[model samples]
Target: MDTRYITSAAKPEQLPDFDLPELAFIGRSNTGKSSLLNALLGRRSLARHGRTPGQTQMINFFSVNDKVVLADLPGYGYNVARRDVAKHWQPMVDTYVRRPNITAFLCLHDCRRNFQELDERLMFMLGRQLPIILVLTKTDKATRNEIRKQKEKLKKRMDELGIDYQVIIETSATKNQGIAELKALVLDPHLQVEDENS
Candidate 1:
């Protein structure tokens, strides 16, 4: 259960050589990505939580039990007014996800808000290549009925897009919900074996 930050890369060339299997976490800014990582690792500060949008601008990597890597990719769809700054993230993220040794992708979305067009586009792009685990974060902020509605809406959109049914998890970092399920997915033996064979 040991965890430690490895490095933060701003570009593809700056990324460390991939040796262990990696499960990358990505989402829009302030989608509880950092909090979820901390909850999963049982650490209070593995990934820094910030109030500011686009606080995590680098591709941060962490080693878990020295067996696998967890990459905290920079959040997208932030600072829409600064199109130039936000534009660079697409290429960087695209390159990192395409890298070798990536086992799966965890795409987090805030349950309090409706899924945006950008989210759909990103999911569509990533879904085409990797096994995507759609995580609905901040569920504690919404009521049971609201959460159910949000899940249904997202599923319908995915179905329309021909995205096969994937594991969709509802999580609340404050409530410690879905943490175990997420950990199970990340540490699944099949994924580890896939990395070993690759």
Candidate 2:
């Protein structure tokens, strides 16, 4: 069966004790993070719809197979109108990434725009320990050449940082592009070694 919804955690303390591995999805608000999560699970709308510039309030959870958990973190880059919201979310995201149970992080970015400095900072901060999969989402909205250009820019930045992520994927939930590869990457740990080895 395809992965289905199990439950959500509004707070880190409420998260259950699970020896199984955990993965997280994080990005700026409206970066299509929730859409990608639903796409990864092969469901239309499993993860809730977030605000245009959302508040960082919860660490939502889903059952990815029976062996692992998927944590949907509050989107980090909400606007200034929600300064307090960002304050609340920044700590939760920092803690979740540092948590012992987290296996990896799927850091989603919008393909149509230049990535922000904060994105780079977050990657720099988190890359120290957990593996991060840099996913360029909404590729369908951009031209092929544009996609290529953006990919190269991201690669250069990552290489310069010397923070090797397990892998980088480009996806468009609308076109069903790169969804299966992402799901497999998230579901199977073996791919990470081979991906890094190659």
Candidate 3:
């Protein structure tokens, strides 16, 4: 699939006009959000990766196959100082989430750590509108048993909260695991139909 960088918006009003279906990826800082985006698009550095956490401070958009738009939202829950920055960006995320064109959310979580409070809050906020595909990132860094446990734990939490989710996928950008499934989930019309029906 062909993909190109679009524009970065600090606020919702600054976002470029686009009518195509949009899917957004969001997670905590250093949670492999950029890496997963690069993997999905089959590009090495399409979404720039930074050494510092909370480096992505704006809402970034990328056009894929001229059919769908992929949004790389700023990561949340970094540190006290960065948390303040995240507070400023939260409203922008809220506005974008409410946009009519956004079809779904690819919510990434680090498989190595237990789900944090920020992840729960984010899920609560986004789950109300769009169908979310919970992605467990950096799965290669964890053992199979650990991955399975984390998935079950997260699924239970999501179930308890009554969050709307399509699936929980384990991914390792380095290993190229779950990249195809993630792409299918994002681009497959049949999956969207099934999600809407569900």
Candidate 4:
């Protein structure tokens, strides 16, 4: 699929005025969001993976085949101080998520570790508001048994939290695992922006 960078929005007004359905990618710092995005799009360095945690401070937008908009949200819960997250990041993220044009959210999680309090908080926030897909990233770092156990554990946590997510996708960006499934999900023709009432 064709993809191109649109623009980065540090404030609400700076966001690109696109009418296309949007998918927002979000997760904690170092969750391999960039790597996964690149893998999904079949392009290397399309999302620019950073070595330092929380390197992405702005919301980066990319157009996918000119049919869908992919919003690369700034990764939270990184090396940032508590005050910085509260004073800046939280409000910015809150504003973006409230927009009606967002079709769904791709929430990434690392397979090597259990979901933390921050991840749960995000799940609770987006639970009933919009469709969510809990993407387990870096699956190649763990064994097949370990991946299965992690998926099962995550399913239990989601069940306990009552998060009605669409699915849990396991992906290894380097090894090209589950990339096709995610890409198809993003490019599904049936997905459309939801209105406030519907």
Best by lDDT: 4
Better of 2 and 4 by TM-score: 4
Model 1 agreement with the true structure over 1-198: per-residue lDDT tens digits = 778889899876788986788888999888989999999998899898767788667889988888889999887777555777667776788788887788788899998777788887888888888757788899889998998888888888888887643578888999998887778766762432211100
lDDT of 2: 0.75
Candidate 2, residue 48: lDDT:
76
User: Please, what is the whole-model Cα lDDT of each candidate in the order they appear?
Assistant: 0.80, 0.75, 0.81, 0.82
Question: Model 3: how large is the Cα RMSD against the reference?
Answer: 3.1
Give the TM-score of each candidate.
Answer: 0.91, 0.89, 0.91, 0.91
Model 3 stretches with alpha carbons more than 4 Å out: 189-198
Model 3 per-residue lDDT tens digits across residues 131-154: 588888998898988877777777
Residue pairs with backbone atoms closer than 3 Å in model 1 (clashes): none
151 in model 4: Cα distance from truth in Å? 1.0
Better of 2 and 3 by lDDT: 3
The TM-score between candidate 4 and the true structure equals 0.91
C-alpha displacement of 113 in model 3, angstroms? 1.7
Query: Model 3: number of clashes?
Result: 0
